[model samples]
Structure formats: structure tokens, C-alpha cells
Target: MNFYLDVDRTIITKEHREALELNDFLKYLFNTGEVYWLTTHCRYEDTSSVLSYIMPFLTLENYDLIKNIFPTTWNTLKTEAINFSQPFYWFDDYLLEVEKRILLENRCLEKWIKIDLDKNGNNIMRAAKSHNPNLFSSI
Candidate 1:
């Protein structure tokens, strides 16, 4: 499965301003499936902007792991970069209306995992604990 990640509230904590279990999450993602950047900070082939923005929140080991996440290119909607043919999951704090529509049309609206730290700070931890090899199938 393909795992797309966003850096903001999805991975970094809004209150603490630090990444919690970011290293472990990245390690799990890389080991289990294909990981990619699907955030505004990263577009096209260059991931320097996203890496620089997330650098302050990550440890040396976390930074190294993050660099391995593949870059994605999209013109308008982030969904454009998504490979609908394969099973995938998108982790983000927010989703645009157009993007939501795209996912809804494709019958994969449930694939978007909305991460709201304000609502529940332990959401990431819960997700980590619930990891499975056949992620989509199990769900």
C-alpha cells in the first residue's frame, strides 16, 4: 500500500511543537509500504522546502528517515498525485473540498485519515498501536 503523509498537525504536535514518535512512524511506514510526501510544503521533484520546514521538529534520526519519503508532483489538487489504482491512505490535518470530492468520487473517502491534534492529541499514538500489514483490507 501507498502511504501519503503531511507534516503539520498530522505528524508534528501543535501544542508541544515537537514530533512524537515520528521516527518510529516513519520506520514503520518505510518498512511496510511505499511512503510519499503529500503536503503543500512539498511538490514536484524537490523536497528541500518540506524537509527544511520539518527539520526543526525532527531529531537527527527522524530527519534522516523523513528524507527517504518519495516526492510527489501535482498541479492543483493533492489527489492528482495519488495512485487510485492501488490501495492507499492519506494522513493529513485538513483536506480541501476538491480533494475530498475526488476521494469521494473514487469511493475511497474512508482512506483519508484526518488527524486532528486539537480534538485528540493521542490520535497518532492510537494509529501507531493499530498498525497492521494489510492496512486497507483489515479496515
Candidate 2:
């Protein structure tokens, strides 16, 4: 499945604090090949600046796979995504409402997922953890 993410104010940040679990979740998604794509609608300058800031933590492979980044406008990208399959996920604080609207309008995309800006509490990570043999407690 492909995971499409909005760049600015989502993954990259400078001020305040970010959740370590959420950060680890993202790194797992990219490193484990669980997500097929990551996208953004932000301007080039903002994307560039964020990428520079995040470069230290991301591996070279992740930097390469992120080539799927598309320069898309918010309204227009919806139409392009209409016919696509593969359990696509849209991750961004900016896209939550839009994703809901699109899901309502486009019946074909009902299977797609809209991930919140917060990425914890009973999600893919928990699902994966369920299968772990080393987990001692009832997690």
C-alpha cells in the first residue's frame, strides 16, 4: 500500500516537541517497506528546508525512496488519485478534512485510509506488536 504524506508541519518541525513513538512509527513505515509512497503539497522551499533538517535521522535508502514526492495542488491531486488502488493512506494535519470530503464524494476510494497528525494509540504498530514473541506483558 502507498502512504501519501503532506510535508510541511507534519513530519518535519523545528520548534516545540514531537512524539518519539510517532517519529519511530514513521521511520518504521519507510524502513520496513510498509508504505509505498509519501507525498506532499507544500512549496519547494519549505520542503527543501524540512528535508535538510530531517536528513540526519533518515537513512540513505529512505532519502532515495522518497523520490515519489509529487508537486501537487490540493484540489487537483484528488482527481489524479481517483482510479488508484493499493490501500493508500493520506497523512497530514492539513489534509484531514479534505480527505474526509473526498471519501464522501468518491465511493471508489472508500477503502483508502486517512491517518491523523497524531500516530499512536492502537494502530499499525499495535497490530504488529501483537505478533511479537518476546512481548512478556499483555500489551
Candidate 3:
């Protein structure tokens, strides 16, 4: 399975200023070798910068490896960039109407996590807990 995430308000939110908690969650996902950044900042040449800001606690080596996850969206539509053949969990604060329709049509809506920054601000942490209650116990 693959894990995709948006930056900005979804992972790094106004409610929670720090990303240590989210980084812990993503670090677990990264170990699976299927984590992806599905945000605008990913369009830049240096995609690692996106994760760097949101995952300040992550080491440079790990960040470099993440940057190597080539296929990081640069001017490509997310729907087209992602291969829906494999199961994936996507977390995004905003999804275009067309994108929502496509996911629903493909029966992939269930995999999408809508991160409403205005409400349910802690959904990311909640997702981590749902995956494993003891996952973030140390952090």
C-alpha cells in the first residue's frame, strides 16, 4: 500500500505548530517505502524542501531518500501522476471537484483522507492511532 500526503494546512496546520508528531507518523510510513508527497511544493526541483518544513525532525539522509521518490508531481495532474492500480491512502486538505469525482468513480474514495484543517485538525494523528495505538506513544 502507498501513503500520499499534502503539505501546507493539512500536515502542518495552524492549530499544531510543530510537525514532530506528523513526522513520527510519516516516518513509520516511510519505512514501508511507499510514502509520497502530493502537494504543489512537490512541483519544485527540490521537492525535499516540502517535507523538510513539515518534517523538521527527520534526518537529512531520510529526507534525501524521500526526494529520490522520483515521480514527485511537477506540473503533472495528481490523478495522472498516481497509479491507482495499487491501494493508496491520500491525505489532502483540498481536492478539486473533478478529482473527487474521479476517485469516487474509481471506488477509491474510501482511501482518501480529507484533512479539513478548519475541523478535525488532528485527523493525521488520529489516522496514526487508528493504524496503531502505540505508534506514537514515545513521541
Candidate 4:
């Protein structure tokens, strides 16, 4: 499966801290599927800004791992960059109403894993430890 990742409160917490298990979660995603940057920071097919923004929060190894994540460009909604024909999951803290409609129309609304760090602080940790394809099922 392809995994689309967002930054901000999804990987980084609402408290402005990096998730404790971020590296592990990233490792799992990288090992299990293709991962891509699906955040505003990486728009226009440029990843430098996003990489710099996330640098301080990652370990050296994870930083290297992150470099392998492909970049995505979307003119409007992030959903524009998504390949609906493939199996994938999108991890994000927030979703636009229009984007939700796109997912619903594609019959893949369940693939969007909403990560609210404010309420579930251990989300990344739980996902990393779960070792299941449905990482957030028990969250």
C-alpha cells in the first residue's frame, strides 16, 4: 500500500513536540509500503522546505529514511495528488471538507487516518507497536 504522510500535528504533536515513536512508525511504513509527502510544506514537488522543517525532530537515521519519501504536488486539494487506483492510506491531523468529499466519492474515506495528537498523545507509539496493517484500528 502507498502511505501518504502529513506533518504538523500528525507526526509532530499539537504540543509542538515530535511523537516519541515517530522513527519506529516511519520505519514500519517505509518497510511495509511506499511513503510520500502529502503536506503543504512539500507542494510544487519540492521537499527541501519540508525536510528542513522536520529535521530537528528526527534522528540521523530517520532523517535519512525520510529522504526516501517521494514528493507530491497538488494544485488545489491534497487529494489531487493521490492515485485513487491504488491501495493507500493518508495520515493527517485535519482534512478539508472538499478533500473528504473526494475520498468519499472514491470509496476510500476509511483510508484517511485522522491523527489528533491533542486527544491521543500516544497515537504514533500505538501504531508503531501494533505491527498490524490496520495500525490505527485500536486507537
Candidate 5:
């Protein structure tokens, strides 16, 4: 499955300002085979340049292994790239009109979890719970 997320508030965060339960869910995800991390963060080379800073919290061994990291504008260009039959989970602070447009074109079974801007953890999980039961056991 493809798991897209926002960098700042989703995965890595200071202990004092972060939610504890996310570790459990993240561990479960990594434990499962075939996981992909997508980010609409900084520009491709820009984000890759900070690999050292991003690796402590993530196991991105090299920048190239980080598939699907692209600009917000790329959302409009990905229509035919992804296999519509495969599952997808997108988490972003602020969803773009283009994101919604792409989601609308996807197969009916796929879900796009619209996460809150503040990283109120578990809302994404809860949203997945209601729609994609396959992820609930992991959550």
C-alpha cells in the first residue's frame, strides 16, 4: 500500500509536543511488508538534501528509496501513474483542490484520509477505521 503523509506534524515531532500512540501504529505499519512513504514536502532535491535530518525518525536509508515524494503540483500529474486497484492512504494538513480531483477519479474503494493541520493523531486512524477495515487491525 502507498502511505502518503505530511512531514512536519505526521511522523517526526518533538516528544513534548507529540502524541505517544503514533509509534504503535507506525511500528505496525513498518512491520507489514510493502509500505511506501510519500511526501509532498519540499522540492525533490531540496528534501533529499536534508536526508540526515530526516533519517533519525525515519529509515530512509537513501534519498532514492523514497518513492513518490513530489511537489503539490504533481498531484495533478499522477492520475495515470498509480494503479487505481491498489490501496492508498494520503495524509496532508491542507488538501488541495487538485488532490480532491484526483481522489474523485480513483476507484470507489480507495480512500484519501484528510488529516487535520494540527496532527490530532488518530483522526486519520479513525477515518480509516470507518472505511478501510484492513488498516484497523494495524492501527
Candidate 6:
């Protein structure tokens, strides 16, 4: 399965904080393979920098695979990038209602995970750890 992610509040946790930590949700997605950035931050350098920043949290064995799938730049919205023919997992704190409707229409709602950074707080680091691993077994 392919993974799409948002950076800002979804990954970085804080906009003003220069040094950031990897949250569990992101770690799980990275390990899953072929992770692509879906943020409004379209610069290639910034994307690379964040990937490097989270390096320590990632398993070294998957580093090469992760690098191969990491996008150099992101210029499209997650909703725009999604292709329903292929299975994809989208993680973002702010998916619009219209976007949700599109996913439902396309029968892609199962993989469109919505996360709230504010409510989850720092516990976002533990978010994916407790999930049912078989939840996507059929995918």
C-alpha cells in the first residue's frame, strides 16, 4: 500500500519549533513503504530536510526502501493525488468535508484516516502502536 502524509501539525506537531520529533503514526507509515509527502510545503529541500530529521526514529533496515519512495517535492493536494484504483492510506489533520465525500464516493473512505493533533496531543506518538495490524489485511 502507498502512504500519503501531511507535515505541519500532522507530523511536525508545532510550526514554530525548529527541532521536531517523529510521531508513531508517521513511523508506522514509513515502515509500511512508499511514503509520499502531501503537504502544502511544496519545496523539495524542505521535504528532504524533514525526512532527514526523522531518520533516527526510522528502522535502519527500511532506510533504503524509504528513500526510494520519499518524494522530492509535493505540489498537489492529497485529495488530488489520490487514485482510487490503487490502495492508499492518507493521514492528515485537516481533510475537508468535500474531500471525505469524494473518498466515500470512490469507496476509498476506509484508508482515509483523519487525525486531530490537538486532541491527541503528544500521544500522537503512540497512535499507531495500538492499532489492529490486521485492519488492512485485505488491502
lDDT of each: 0.79, 0.44, 0.63, 0.82, 0.47, 0.57
Q: What are the per-model C-alpha RMSD values against the true structure?
A: 3.0, 7.4, 5.2, 3.2, 5.7, 5.1
Write down the TM-score of every candidate.
Answer: 0.85, 0.44, 0.67, 0.87, 0.55, 0.63
Model 6's TM-score against the true structure: 0.63
Model with the higher TM-score, candidate 3 or 5:
3
Candidate 4 lDDT tens digits, 69-97: 99998988999999999999888878999
1-139 per-residue lDDT for model 1 (tens digits): 8999987787888753655556666777787799999988888978999999988877888788888999999888899899999988888878999899999999999888776666654456455334433453453
Q: What is the C-alpha local distance difference test score of candidate 5?
A: 0.47
Q: Give residue 134's error in model 3 in angstroms.
A: 14
Full candidate order by lDDT, most accurate first: 4, 1, 3, 6, 5, 2
- Best model per TM-score: 4
Candidate 4 error regions (>4 Å): 127-133, 136-139
- Give lDDT: candidate 4, residue 94: 87
Candidate 2 TM-score, true structure as reference: 0.44
Residue range 98-133, candidate 5, lDDT tens digits: 656777866532456544424444333443344456
Q: How accurate is candidate 4 locally (lDDT)?
A: 0.82
Candidate 4 has its poorest 10 consecutive residues by lDDT at 127-136
Clashes of each: 0, 0, 0, 0, 0, 0
For model 2, the superposed segments whose C-alpha errors exceed 4 Å read 13-19, 31-50, 53-83, 96-99, 107-139
Please write out the lDDT profile of model 3 over residues 39-77, one tens digit for every residue.
Answer: 887764456567666456345554555564443554646
The local distance difference test score of model 1 is 0.79
Better of 3 and 6 by lDDT: 3
Candidate 6 residue-wise lDDT, 1-139, digit = tens: 7877766666545543311234344456666656776766534535566567655544554344445445535344457766567778776768778788888889878676665555555344443222324443443
Model 5 — TM-score against the truth?
Answer: 0.55
User: Can you write out model 2's per-residue Cα lDDT over 1-139, one digit (the tens) per residue?
Assistant: 4555544334433232332344455665565334432344343323554455455654555455454344333334543443355444455435446655776676634334333334433243442233332221321
TM-score of 4: 0.87
Q: Relative to the unseen true structure, what is the C-alpha lDDT of residue 39 in candidate 3, on a scale of 0 to 100?
A: 81
Number of the candidate with higher lDDT, 1 or 2: 1
